[model samples]
Target: MSLTKEQLLDYYRKMRNIREFEETIHRENTTGEIPGFLHLYCGEEANAVGVCAHLSDDDYIASNHRGHGHCVAKGSDPRLMVMELYGRAEGLCGGKGGSMHIADLDRGSLGANGIVGAGAPLATGAALTQKVKGRDNVSVCFFGDGASNEGYVFEAMNLAVILKLPVIFYCENNGVGEGTGVDYAVGADSIADRAAAFGMPAKKIDGTDFFSVYDAMEEVVAHCRAGNGPYFVEAETVRFYGHFEGDPQKYRLKEEIDNAKLHRDCLKKFRSRVIEEGLATTEEFDSIDSDLVAAYKGYVAEAKQAAWPRPEALTEDVYITY
Candidate 1:
């Protein structure tokens, strides 16, 4: 790996932060502390961290509903994020936008969208702006295996390729699109093949492996930054959680879930790799995790204590009455 020990450890902490934050919210949602529905990004940490590691704060990323990991990977404050989940006044979107729509434009996070495949166009637009303005900054569009089949996604890809925009189509193909399998929805033999048809650099990677995801993304990000056109990456990841917090998941096999947790967990794979490479120790990673637990604990607690958005502010950012 070209990454330093310090860099690998930093990635570890970022993944841990996402895992802990999602698990915490999963528990808190049951007690009603976290408002609104959620699509937890429990097992897709590597996909987000790997790609975002190559992006700057000036580079934009558009995310889907399962977006906490993306936001954390891109440097959104965990405290404000937790507050957003709680619909507090000080949240990321001033509490109006919950889990599905957390935007931090200053951080270049376009937002966690509710509409599937919508972020692709937004990222495309960001990339177009960069290209037109002669900026080297690239934009990343993180979507799911399901959204990969969306018409808007293909449209965005076509535009991006034709315009030679600096955008990366990062598809977290978790095999399951909500409840239906990817094979059912995506007519293409492989989702990445869609990009292949467009003559874009398409890679199908093992998303459970941090190094694998990171390395692939590093090359793509580098290429895009060098003024190359858009690329497509299909990361074969696993979603440890169901479609939603309360999803019965009748479609999922318990054994598959167990197998994924045991053998395909990104955190486990990452920890093993780092330790084997002599880059870090188990105790060292655990220490970082301890701090993460405390930080998330504080974030959730502070969010609980935060005030709600004022009633008068409800219509404040809605429209133009003049």
Candidate 2:
């Protein structure tokens, strides 16, 4: 809320990038251009951008299956990301890791994991590294509400608090996990309440509101930077698409989904606030969106003709055993 106009625009650009990139991938996936399963982050832009805005290139982040947004928000190259989806050799992981495992260490992106709740431990390890080196860097773990149910999440929290490691357990609660509603999966009233048991400060905010998430994470990031150990944030968000591309989504109500899209859209909300506050015009945001869409299309075209991984390199990064 205290952000300058430039910073606000930057947030808008990042959110727009994530939304466009995921929607593009969703469209391309329908054509079978991408081979692996994709957990598109269509409606969860605010969570990723808001949190990552407070982080630096020196900070670390480990993400879940719905991770493209996290990578882009954490400063991963869009072109390289597209190439990775196409299984090109020039990809972030030489296309071997595909979408679920895209990573860029230089950017402090630990990588997206296929395993549920796995990122928490990885982030804790990174936080340990920060603690050992006495660096001010913090590690953030981005997982879904489903992953919060995983046992490792609690373990990671315990370790983080015990070691006083600087980390943040960010839970993007989209209200549905895989094909099941979160209310059916989680026993507690809210996911962030678990933080109380760990003695970590927790915040539950409107994931659809960029400012809400940004304000909460700004505090959390500052706390971690001061070596205040780990904190927990449950962003009550919504996913526009199903868990994966081609999912039937029979579990979700059509009207509910439509209502969220129409009334709870983060971009629409953000734009209205910015305009209402006299911070910027709709035309300025529109211009940024136009440029992003064009650039994304160009990236998609380039990725289509990108070089594929060599057959000889199939076993290159593999760990072989007898």
lDDT measured at residue 12 in model 1 versus the true structure, 0 to 100: 95
Write down the lDDT of every candidate, Cα atoms only. 0.92, 0.93
Q: What is the lDDT of residue 1 in candidate 2?
A: 52
For each of the candidates, give the backbone clash count. Answer: 0, 0
Give the Å shift of residue 302 in candidate 2: 0.9
| Clash tally for model 1 | 0
What TM-score, computed on C-alpha atoms, does each candidate reach? 0.98, 0.97
In model 1, the clashing pairs are none
- lDDT by residue for model 2 (184-264), tens: 899989999989989888999999999999988888999999988899999999999999999989988999999999988
lDDT of 1 at 60: 99
Residue-level lDDT tens digits of model 1 in 80-133: 999989999999889999999988899999999999999999999999999999
Residue 262 displacement (Å), model 1: 0.5
TM-score of 1: 0.98
